[model samples]
Target: MSTTFWIIIAGAIATYLTRIGGHLVISRFDNIHPRVEAGLNAVPAAVLTTLVAPELLNAGPAEWAALVVTAVVSLRGGLMAMFLAGAAVLILARQFVG
Candidate 1:
């Protein structure tokens, strides 16, 4: 009921409408060009690598050590290994730090 609430509601509505509008417009284009499709496919991977690279490389000693353990487990055990290793690291970190 306040001005801030109305502003937030308006912003949410605008965001939703913009996304829906993009989908509608792009849907009318019969087929994506091959280059554009390839770019789209690579976008998420590029973004994720950019996001994860710093965390994986630039952390403190324990964090780096955890990542090493994670990498070993991840390589040997697949996705499950990654999750278990991450959980172990998180628990250990909490115990030591917080």
Candidate 2:
């Protein structure tokens, strides 16, 4: 196998190990502290920010329009709705802007 293939396999294995390891450790505790739970709940938002912040630096008008639509939809809808709204706006805006 190529080096790239091995690297992908290694990364997948590492990710799986970390996920399972966390589950195992948490399951050992009967009750989770509120602070720990709050931190866990915040992980998704933090991850999303990390992913989106870099993209903003190079975003075009189409991307900005999609982001605004996504944020608006997220305030009133679920994850699926937010994703679909953003995608629809991105496609439509790109057609005209690009």
The model with the greatest lDDT is: 2
All candidates' lDDT scores?
0.80, 0.95
Q: What is the lDDT of residue 83 in candidate 2?
A: 97
Scored by lDDT, model 1 comes in at 0.80
Clashes of 2: 0
- lDDT string for model 1 (21-69, tens) is 8688778999989999999789878997888788865577567667677
Q: Specify the poorest-scoring 10-residue window by lDDT in model 2.
A: 18-27
Instruction: Give Cα distance to truth, residue 80, candidate 2, Å.
Output: 1.9
Candidate 1, superposed: residue stretches over 4 Å from native = 1-22, 69-81, 93-98
Runs in model 2 lying further than 4 Å from the true structure: 29-38
- All models, RMSD in angstroms: 4.5, 2.3
* lDDT minimum window of 10 residues, candidate 1: 56-65
lDDT of 2 by residue, 6-83 (tens): 999999999999889878898899999999999999998999899999999999999999999999998999999999
Error of 2 at 87 (Å): 1.3
